[model samples]
Target: MAETRPVWVIYDDGSTGHMEIPEGDGDPALAKPGRLVTEAEYTARLEEIRAARAARHEAEETARLEAARADYDALIAGGFPEATARRLSGYQGTQAPAA
Candidate 1:
């Protein structure tokens, strides 16, 4: 098996603060009793973090676009053309969004 190492972290302060260093490689005094993780575990954790971040960004963008579409519709209903409504409401789509 590949060499594994400690991932130093103390979560009592309600903040994310972790340092990755192999046991006995870095100063022992600086390390908080952390968990030992394999390289595979570390890489998997990184992928999970990346996926969660992407999902969050996608959800945020979907919400923003939905809001813009609503604004565009409201402007159109209030006597504006499709182009004018989209322009005024910052809607990026050229056609009405699918229901």
Candidate 2:
């Protein structure tokens, strides 16, 4: 009955769905059947959204890793052990501890 609250109903197929019942006005069409989207359609839509998000995440991760690699390379060039450099190269976090 709240203005922004959503009304949900369980279908016979065991699926839960929502109907927005506006507090001030209720449309008669709300009782009518809702639009049914195909499974593949929903899957494709979600996949596209997830792929875009993942692409951005991968780009940021790559930038961070490359920066870390550069720092490790600098350490190796400064006479640090290859093992230490390799360990620093693979570390993933906000800040790397002093070697």
Candidate 3:
């Protein structure tokens, strides 16, 4: 029986995926335009990719919050009701009172 191992499939455009293949398969369809890597290296790279995605999500959330705050302030300044402003800004009215 042939032993199967995890191989990290790296694409030319810098994307990555994984597959399990038997040792010495070396199929051109799987090897061309993509490099195979050890499981340990694949795991480490996956962690780095996940961390980067998390950081980007956090940053986007922060920006969204900032924009919401600006909209809330503008609504308040325009004499709209506080509850209505909160709703428009995607808040649940449980947020701390605006300064």
Where model 2 places Cα greater than 4 Å from the true spot, the runs are 1-44, 91-99
Q: Which ten residues in a row have the lowest lDDT in candidate 1?
A: 8-17
> Which 10-residue window in model 2 sums to the lowest lDDT?
27-36
TM-score of each: 0.65, 0.44, 0.77
On a 0 to 1 TM-score scale, where does candidate 1 land against the true structure?
Answer: 0.65
Model 3 superposed RMSD (Cα): 2.7
Ranking by lDDT: 3, 1, 2
Q: What's the lDDT of the predicted structure labeled candidate 2?
A: 0.61
Encode model 3's per-residue lDDT on 3-65: one tens digit a residue. 986668666655677877788877436644767666787778778889999999999988888
State the lDDT of candidate 2 residue by residue for 13-83, as single tens digits: 43434555567654324344444344564456557667888999999989988888787768777888867
Clashing pairs in 2: none
Q: How far is candidate 2 from the true structure (C-alpha RMSD, Å)?
A: 10.4
User: Lowest-lDDT window of 10 residues in candidate 3?
Assistant: 27-36
lDDT of 1 by residue, 36-86 (tens): 445566566667678888999999999999899899888988888777888
Number of the top-ranking candidate, with lDDT as the measure: 3
Highest TM-score model number = 3
